[model samples]
Target: VVKYGKWLVAAGAVGMNVLAARDHNRAEDVFGALEARCSDDPRLCDLGDGGAYLDPGTEALYQQSVGYDRRARRWLIGGETALLGAAAMFVWELTRKTHRPDNIPFEPEVRSLRNATGVGLRLSF
Candidate 1:
């Protein structure tokens, strides 16, 4: 059970790491696209007024991309948390001690009990 648990935890950690990497990559892609668009068009820059001007329909696309990037960031955080938890669990399971009766050095001894003499076992680690 311990071995299986460790394996599962390790797998979960790896999976979460992969997910986080993918999300990070996606966010980078979106940022790259935004940069590319801005570079390709000079008008995409901020105007002199407080309100910046964007191409027709381009503003909605940019907004949607930003929203997607934000969502990806959230997923990345979740994946990181999961990965950390799984890694800790894996370490805990791997480092846990198991008790084996055969491994213990138990010796038979004569002992005096209350109102009786009896044979007893003494254990030594």
Candidate 2:
């Protein structure tokens, strides 16, 4: 059970990390698209004291990119947490003591009755 739990946590960590990477990539793509759009239109690149002036559509796209970035950060945090859990489980398993019994030695006996001789092996569990 402990072994399985460790593996499960490790798998979850990997999954979360993968999701984070995918979201990060998506965020990059969206930001790149936004940049391309801004470069094509000078009006979209106008910067004021507050921030760059963005149209409604461009603003929505920027917000989408921000959302992706936020999601990526969340997944990364989750992945790190799962990875730590897995590491802790591994350490716990390593430090745990097993309840296995000690090895038992086998004894062989030879008996002779009448004109017959037989050998018998004995084992204790």
Strongest candidate by lDDT: 2
Model 1 local distance difference test score: 0.66
Clashing pairs in 2: none
Best by TM-score: 2
lDDT of 2 by residue, 1-125 (tens): 77889999999999999999999999999999889988899687665576745576677778899999999999999999999999999999999997865675777889998989989999876
Error of 2 at 118 (Å): 34
Quick one: how many clashes does candidate 2 have? 0
lDDT of 2 at 61: 74
Model 1, position 32: C-alpha lDDT score: 74
Superposed by TM-score, candidate 2 places the C-alpha of residue 12 at a distance from the truth, in angstroms, of: 0.5
